[model samples]
Target: MKRRKFIGLLGGAAASWPLAARAQQTRMPAIGFLRSSSSAPSQFLATALREGLKEQGFVEGQNVQIEYRYAEDEKERLRNLATDLLARPLAVIVADTIAAIQIKAAATTVPLIFASGGDPVAAGLVTSLNRPGGNVTGVVFFATLLGAKRLELLRRAVPNAAMIGVLTSRTSPNVEAERGDIEAAALALGQQLTVVDVNGEDEFDTAFVTFIRSGARALLIGSGTLLTTNRARIIALAARHALPAVYPHREGALDGGMMSYGASVADAYRQAGIYAGRILKGEKAADLPVMRSSKFEFVLNLRTTKALGIDIPPTLLALTDEVIE
Candidate 1:
């Protein structure tokens, strides 16, 4: 009887040992990265995001894990992607302003951090900028609000342009605001503006043809993931049309667009990453105030200018933060 009792006690202890050991192994937190752009263009943004996480004492694959879901510019896939990310036991979700909407609708408990080009307050993602007051808080670049400024630069680059073609993505929620701002700006500048709506990548060539037929001397590319993802083709179209154009972000100029003026997208992503790390470290999402993107840059590509036979204005070139010869 004593021997049997000892064996039973030893077996129970052995089973409990493995359970204790498994409990001791902490599961690492995961960050779900949801975007509407492709991975190829997102390399720099991803690196910047990682750098931000490093700043918060979190390293990918070490203390934290990042699950990336790129929709490759297909807006239709965003809701499904958000649902899939929600299925995972994610510690937090970091996304673009547009994607943030979908994620917000899918998960109510999981915290959301975003890097958006639109106004979060206007989009109803947050109650206010100073106090987000919800499970979502991150950075806003306000790229759509800079339409007038970009048009001004395009006008400066092509002084004689009376009519400018504005390419906008109709599917984006921010389109109406962008159009209103751009139209007001164009009227203020005394330049005729033709707004062309592009719904997908396939409509790009047709939009360019429409712009050409409308007799536009210059073009203003709108802000959105769809436009940014297909930047190379749009820039090519602009070059083929011999149209001097201005883009929203530096990536466009770096990718061979004529000129760009907007917030640094990579920096915004880095900020989002930093916020995500903080949230994972026990900081409440509502307590963290929304951050506005302040790092705007003006980039000019002289090579594209020369190729299109458009002379860069001395004043505009002087204002350029970066000039690609």
Candidate 2:
């Protein structure tokens, strides 16, 4: 009887040991990263996000596992990718664009941390930026506001231009939604707006030709991951057309666009990263307040302006965060 009792006790202890070990093994959260742009690993933006995560004590490989998926400009790929990622028990899903919309369409149960270029409310990603009612929340760029500011800066840079061409990707995720904002800015500046729409990577030349024929004296390049990816072609086209152009990214200005004014992308990435870290640390997405960019950066290229015979105003020069002489 004693030997039988000992064997029963030993069996019970063995059964409970695995459960105890699992309970104490330090649960590592999983982060699912999905983006519309190329996963520019070398970008300081990626580093900033990691730094923010580290600040929350979430080590990428040790304490947390990050499953990175890049669509690299293919919208359809995000849908399929989201479906596959759903199989994993992700702690948080960082959906960084219209890609978020796609991810949500596929997986509604998983909490989503989205970083979007347009109004979150309008995109149907969340109920409100402050209190995103469902299992989704993150950040907004308020791209419309950014567009208006970019136009304001462009007008300051080229005060004499009467006709302004706004170049946008026709297939951009939020192109239709952003038209009104750009239109309003054009009216405010009292400049004739020639909205040039390019639908594909190969359509830039056709659009620039149309801009010239349409009597555009200057250009306003829309902010989109797609357009920025083809920065070299865009810059070359602007130069070939001899049009003074403003872009939404500093990289564009650095590549010789006349000017740029928009959210500090790296700053937004860091902010998003912090939110991801919080989620990884067990913070609910709905409770984590989504933040808009606090600052916009202005970059000016004097050489590009000179090529187009546009002399930037002193007032504009004074406001620039960076100027390439």
Candidate 3:
């Protein structure tokens, strides 16, 4: 070959090398993060998920890529968002309970890791907790089943209240289960319960009004993405009414709700992230048993309690995992 041709060939190869490297970087494995709620309220959960991914040596934007889709609490948008994610070449999908249900309905073949507060079996997300024999498996925090526990705690905070109001979401997958649990507990405790369901923020005022009219002296906020997303508004309403309310997640107490009892939502998300990382590393979702989150936190906000002129029972305080002063 001519000397000039050889030099030109080398120059072309060097230029192509950078393009090749860029192409390779762009081809990094991607995972989809889908949620049925708004992003701002659940930012901490997302951070926890990233931390878990990091634990498995997968960092977003470095070795793995994450594509996020949020429905902003609109149930109708979930299927569309999921369909969009499914169109991509995703190694796995990490989604909240409702979003996971919708994705499965879409007949997606990709591995799915769900962070759910409800019963995965009841919701048909999986076959069983011990063996989730499908392309879907994830973390269950049992937030739905904790209604009875929350009711017991709420009664401790307001022992003499003739009626306790329960606020739940109509759209929640766990609504029926949570209602049954709370009702059974209420009956067992000889507590009169007035349960109200709201589908959106617009219906909150009506729900509160119903509770007030029903002579509900205390409140128990139920588990659901919608309820968790609109916690601030519900907290304000409870405060305005001077009602002592118990919430399902720690964030509620952190944001000024009187108290909260349930599993650590952030931890559940982290567990789902870990599962997603493992799936990316060639583990089948079917082979990985559904993980039940073991970390449960009962947070009591002394400030909120004091503001409402409510006293926390000594026995209940003893059982608290955290006291936010």
Candidate 4:
């Protein structure tokens, strides 16, 4: 009878062992994603990020979960929403710009991966780029002031323009700093930069009026995603006023703006996705140094140039990575 009891006990223990193993395997890691713009996910980056995660064995509904929060209309709410997600066991949090600001303050221990359009060190997100030193490290969209290069490209597209207009958001947090960069670049190029601040549809009229009044023959627009989203209206306004315009990113050019010169947004976001997957595979955020955009896209829309009565330089057309006719 003692031998029979011993065998029975062994069977029970074996069954219980699998239970403990299953318990350990069942606890899914979670990630929190904060999007400041409604169009963020619709872009190719979001999809690329998900694809990266899948490659790293992080099947969204299977091994890991992500809590998504979007402050679509009111970007001001990103921080508060991120704070709410802080109550959970988040393995990593992905944010950008103002959304990153809130995530940094909400968790002291959780890892953060950010892809912002500003200086990470200047923004107080990390100690340095090579060694982020803490729970933060990602990529920067504004690698440098490519503003003047953009202006030069616009001039090439519209060779007859003797004056160029600059449109920017007077209310952007980095407005003044960006203005200085653009001014310095324009000065170095011996090109005059006329500044026009637009904040709303009505303000656009006065802003364009001021641009023309300043004798700006072409428009070089600034600001970050805020300006990119309003590209349709800006493009229309530029066309209506018969002024050639240069935008910061290819998206705007694709949206009908005359030309764009800047880092490839699609590739940066793809890298973000790759980073996210690496983190899931036991790579620490601190170990992964931030990367600058090595690839810059020069996009020119032949259709837009024709509509503006401008002739795109053969040199500029030859340098373009993609020309939309």
Candidate number of the best lDDT: 3
Candidate 4, residues 186-231, lDDT tens digits: the string is 7887787688766544588888889888888889888554565566
Q: Which stretches of candidate 4 lie over 4 Å from their true place?
A: 1-24, 39-42, 73-75, 170-173, 198-206
| lDDT (Cα, tens digit) per residue for candidate 1, span 28-62 | 88899988777877778888899999999999998
- For all predicted structures, in order, the TM-scores are 0.93, 0.85, 0.94, 0.84
Instruction: TM-score winner between 1 and 3, please give it.
Output: 3
* Best TM-score among the predictions, by candidate number: 3
Worst 10 residues of 1 by lDDT: 71-80
What digit string (tens of lDDT, one per residue) describes model 2 on residues 119-223? 777778888878887788887765545777777777777677688888887656678767778898778767788897786678888889889998887889886
Candidate 3, poorest ten consecutive residues by summed lDDT: 104-113
> RMSDs, each prediction?
2.6, 4.3, 2.4, 4.7
Task: Give residue 87's lDDT in candidate 3 (0 to 100).
Answer: 92
lDDT (10s digit) by residue, model 3, range 1-325: 6999999999999999999999987788998999999988878888999998998999999989889889987867887898899999899999999999999987548999999999899899999888898799999898899999999889888998899999999989999999999999889888999999988889999999999999999999999999998999999999999899999999999999999999889999888888888988899999999998787899999999999988888998999999999
For candidate 2, report its TM-score. Answer: 0.85
Candidate 3 lands at a TM-score of 0.94
Compared with the true structure, all predictions reach lDDT values of 0.88, 0.78, 0.91, 0.75
lDDT computed for candidate 2: 0.78
Reference-based lDDT, residue 318, model 2: 89
Clashing pairs in 3: none
